[model samples]
Target: MISAAGLLVQQRALAGRDYRLIGHSGARAAFSLGRWRIALEVLLWAVLALVLAAPLLALVASSLVPAYGVPLNFNTISLSAYAEILFRQSITLTALKNSLILASAAALGLLTVTVPAAYLLTRRKGALANLIAILIEIPYALPGIVLAVAFILTFAAPLPVVGLSLYGTIWIILAAYFSSFLAVSLKPVLSAFLQMDPALEEAARLAGAGFFRRMRDVLLPLVAPAAGASVILVFLIAANELTVSALLWSAGTQTLGVAIFNLDDSGSSDLASALSVLVVILVIALMAALEYLAKHLPEGVLPWRN
Candidate 1:
């Protein structure tokens, strides 16, 4: 129907137009895809936060519901359950104190050990340093229950000592708490340090600052926010820790977490729920404090921001 030369030229022109249309379509699709990806990422984070928060909010609301005959219908609500748990109990009060003391103490102990060690570990990378790093890893690599059992084996018995034992003591709690979370407390700050410029520290040291003075005035203040966040995380883990507490707790030294479990075993969800809600509140308060501290912290110190 057409000459070969004419058909070839016509076909090339048609092909050119088709390619241009395809290219434009692809460009438009890419723009749409980029926008969708960003929206999806934002949506995912928002949904995750909401999902994580929903159960806690529900527990708090349910705990505040009345336990007795004034059944709530469509919109009826009351605080009888909260009042009953909060005011009408005494163990919870003890639990409150016990949890606070144990958690805060454990956090303090972790920082005491971890901060210096973390700094030291990052400052040098040699044989002894590697050994220390590996040793810290030993606790984290094994299951927590295994470590709990190991502690009980070592400290609960007097194989090496004729009369010394730390069984069922606060020290045991602190030891487990320290061992369990030391790595987490160290890792973030260590990574931050590795990425951070060391010249700042060197300059300060050269300007006649002693080692302890430099740590106190320079590095500590600089990394304090990460340290604060680590403190809160370790404290929360310590406060809510049950495995070691259950295995190693003395009657006189039972933490609130274990105590709550004990109470609930006697079939008191109301009390357990109250404790759960309180723990949530305690963690929230700790997070709020960490956030407040972060707000005041200088940019170079907690550069990660979260």
Candidate 2:
């Protein structure tokens, strides 16, 4: 009995009502999802505070206390622990110096080797390069303890020509570090090279730039940021290194990690805690520096950034 116009009008009214319902449901679903995301973010922050911030606060507090078991209070707190580690303890100073030297040496030394090796590995692209890459990675892939043992076995004897022994010496530790961290130092430079256009180097070559000239002029400038990042990464890891240094360290060769362990073992827990706090501070400062440098470096050069 209805006219066609009236029927069309009725259908349009139903469609509008259905659309309103759908719009309301969608808004509700979006609101619910937003609430869940906020809740998850809050939970994540809470967990980080509980796990990371709490321990760090406790460590700082413990380091301030005069002794390991002393209760932390305004009256009981003192800077003696820090002073003792910084000025009073000769062993601690030695350990600090050794750690710095090793870290710097390892970082710079690895850069020289990794830069050329990474260049070759990146540009060559063949089965031989792949095999060499795998070989370089094997030392790092092995457990620190395993690699340390392997080094000890390999260098326990005196050299044939030099007639000098590396076992139980800093040289041996440096060698182990070279092997263990070769991969770490290589990765950033390799990433930089991979991202680079090959045409730039080719153009330089066509212009009669020799290998060293090209590397010094073209390649080095391009990869400097990544190389710096690699150096920092290697320095950070080597400075705090424990496992490899533990087995290789002899008299007067204690690294920071070894010093911390030795201090705790010898019942100088307060000193150990103080040293640990300093190490933490150093690490935080370096990370902040790296974060600031991240803006200038290429994407993905610093893994922690994004």
Top TM-score hit: 2
| Pairs of colliding residues, candidate 2 | none
lDDT of 2 by residue, 24-110 (tens): 223223345666888898999999999999999888888999778889998999989999999999988999999999999999999
**Mind giving the per-residue lDDT tens digits that candidate 1 earns over 254-292?**
787787898778766556766788787877787677668
TM-score of each: 0.73, 0.87
Report lDDT (CA) for all predictions.
Answer: 0.69, 0.85
> Which residue runs does candidate 2 get wrong by more than 4 Å?
1-33
Question: Against the true structure, candidate 2 has what lDDT?
Answer: 0.85
lDDT of 1 at 156: 81
